[model samples]
Target: MVRGKTQMRRIENATSRQVTFSKRRNGLLKKAFELSVLCDAQVALIVFSPRGKLYKFASSSMQETIQRYRNHRKDVHNTLREQHLQQLKQEAIELMKKIELLEASKRKLLGEDLGSCTCEELQQIQQQLEQSLKRIRERKIQVFKEQIDQLKEKEKSLAAENEMLCEIREKIGQQARQESNEDREMVALTESSENSDVETELFIGPPEGRIKRTLTSLYI
Candidate 1:
């Protein structure tokens, strides 16, 4: 029968744990030695027991392996650091370019640096300003027309009022002339009636003095 796989766990008993540590340590060292001899490869191993006992195996001098490992780690660290620095430098250059573009845009918005603008850009700005001027002129003309219309209306109203006043004055003058003519006619009629009302007497005869003398002589 095939054996079932072993489940690994920490040993609960101190004695069992120590025994297992010794066996595993020896086995690991043997495997390191065999790998070096058979494969002609450099190998190193280190182990520390629970009690702080040290064990190690090396195909070469232990100090040499440690020094090589340290050197390799240092080389890797320097390579990574150089790569990071180069990446940062590239990003900084891109950021500076972006900043320069932003500053140029700001200058253009503020109406500065027009000398450096291309023909197309200048044309665009010119068209915009011209459109604004046209709008302003149209608005001014509209306002002037409105004012002129109002003035014309006022002039017409004043003319009508003047005509009405002139007609009223002429009517009053005609009525006064008619009243004066009637008064003069009445005064002439009264004076003719007064002349006609005076009294008068009339008689017809010869000389009375000669007739009286002849009659008196005869009688004497």
Candidate 2:
């Protein structure tokens, strides 16, 4: 008959549990000793019973083994810490490089840091600046044209005003000349009337000469 597999668990009975603890402790110590002797390996084992009894085994001095374990752990910890610090330092270096690149890019955008630029970069910047200058010049020319148009309009208005003023002056001069000619013609007519009165007086004899002739006739 084939036997069934035993299920491993804690023994409920106190005496049986103590017996099992004793047997397992001795067996575990024996296995540890054998493993150390056969393989020339260092071993340490420790156990605590339910009654607070200590059971321990070590291939070497227990204190020495514990110290060695602690030292090994310390070394592992130091190694991991050093690796972490090195990774952090590498990350910091990369971050610094990124920051420097950003700063350089910012300076370039602001029209600074040109001395270190490559030929292609310089050419690109020059092209952009030239395009901006062309746009600015075009705008300036447009503004100048608008201003010139305004000035031309103003000049046309001023020319019209000057022509109107010239016409007004010509009309005023013509009126003045007409008035002067009328005054001259009136003076000439007055002078001709005065001369005709003088001629009529001379054509008729003097009243004194007629009186003297009548007195002489009465005397005769």
Candidate 3:
């Protein structure tokens, strides 16, 4: 092939294009075979024709040659990937150092450990720390307000339960009092002589010597 002599244009004639494809394909396959034999190297070449037919050549079995090529490419990619990972690791270390410096500066600003800083530096640090603290305090207040709301809700629920229990206790107490009064009345009626002494003018009886409710009260 002539070096840099061809114009950058397609061969429009179908027959010329087909002829060129065949000749170039043969030359490429010849070059691959020569490289394999002369350099004691494995080689593989694959070409797809315009009609979608495959054309191929290899110094040995196509599978073995292709496998060798793939392995060679994989080794190169692995080396590059390792180099990239090492670069990333170095960058990560740098980032960590920066973070440590920033944290130390922040601690100094907060008036935490000022043994190493000058008075002026401490003042600047304090100013920055005050701003940060103000932000944090605002956030804390917001959280506290939310908690207070939650507590209020819980108090409302508990109050409702307490009111219900109080009502139930009052009803039970009233029922017990009514039962006790009934029991007392029955006991006095059974005595037969006591009611006449206490309320003789207001009381009446069915007959003398008649008693009522001698048995204990039944739930039914």
Candidate 4:
């Protein structure tokens, strides 16, 4: 039984070592499975023989569970590191804010905010203001480029739409022209019919003199 004291050293005999490894491996696997089944726990077990053969088991994927374990352990170790880094970032931001506030206070004391700053503070403010201005200029350049791109795309779309509109307008104009010509032809034919009827009436019954007068009237 394991209750008996044994020397705290590696087993020297190859056979005994092998036997011990086998027994312990079986016990470890049984315990792993029992924990998974009874407690609904995710479990993974791995062992390598002296000959370097892989032995692995898991409640789910052996590889995935081992990887998860390693990642979880790493995250745990880095928690304090993440906190420290976050604190440093906060401190930096606070320090910058304080520097800005201090500069502003000094400016106000010198009546700069009210339009009278010492030459030294003015120089410092100018340098910082120049840096800020440069950053804004860079941002504006990027925005301007984006706006130009958008304008180019918009112009292309408008060009295409305008082309379509021009084609539609031309078609409408052509149709109107066709309709006008048809109306003119109809008017000409109607006038010709009236003149022919008048001539036939004159030839059938009217006197020659009256016919000439009618012709003159018709011409008028």
Give the whole-model CA lDDT for all candidates, comma-separated: 0.88, 0.92, 0.86, 0.89
Give, for candidate 3, the lowest lDDT window spanning 10 residues: 211-220
Q: If both were scored by lDDT, which would come out higher, candidate 1 or candidate 2?
A: 2
TM-score of each: 0.50, 0.49, 0.49, 0.38
TM-score of 3: 0.49
Q: Model 3 Cα displacement at 75 (Å)?
A: 2.9
Per-residue C-alpha lDDT of model 3 across residues 1-220, encoded as one tens digit per residue: 6678777688999999999999999999899989999998877889999899999888789988778778989999999999999999999999999999999987876567789888898778778878989999999999999999999999999999999999999999999999999999999887877766667554255544233422222322
Residue-by-residue lDDT tens digits, candidate 4, 1-220: 4788878799999999999989988999999999999999999888899989888888998788988989999998799789999999999999999999999877765546946567886677777778979999999999999999999999999999999999999999999999999999999999999999898865455588777888999999
Give the candidate order by descending TM-score.
Answer: 1, 3, 2, 4
Clashes of each: 0, 0, 0, 0
Which structure among the candidates has the greatest lDDT?
Answer: 2
Query: Worst lDDT window (10 residues) for model 1?
Result: 198-207
lDDT of 2 by residue, 5-97 (tens): 856987889998899889988999999999999999999999999989888999999999999999999999999999999999999999999
Shift in Å, residue 52, candidate 2: 0.9
Name the regions of candidate 4 deviating beyond 4 angstroms.
Answer: 1-3, 70-74, 87-220
**Residue pairs in candidate 1 whose N, alpha carbon or C atoms collide under 3 angstroms:** none
Candidate 1, position 165, lDDT: 96
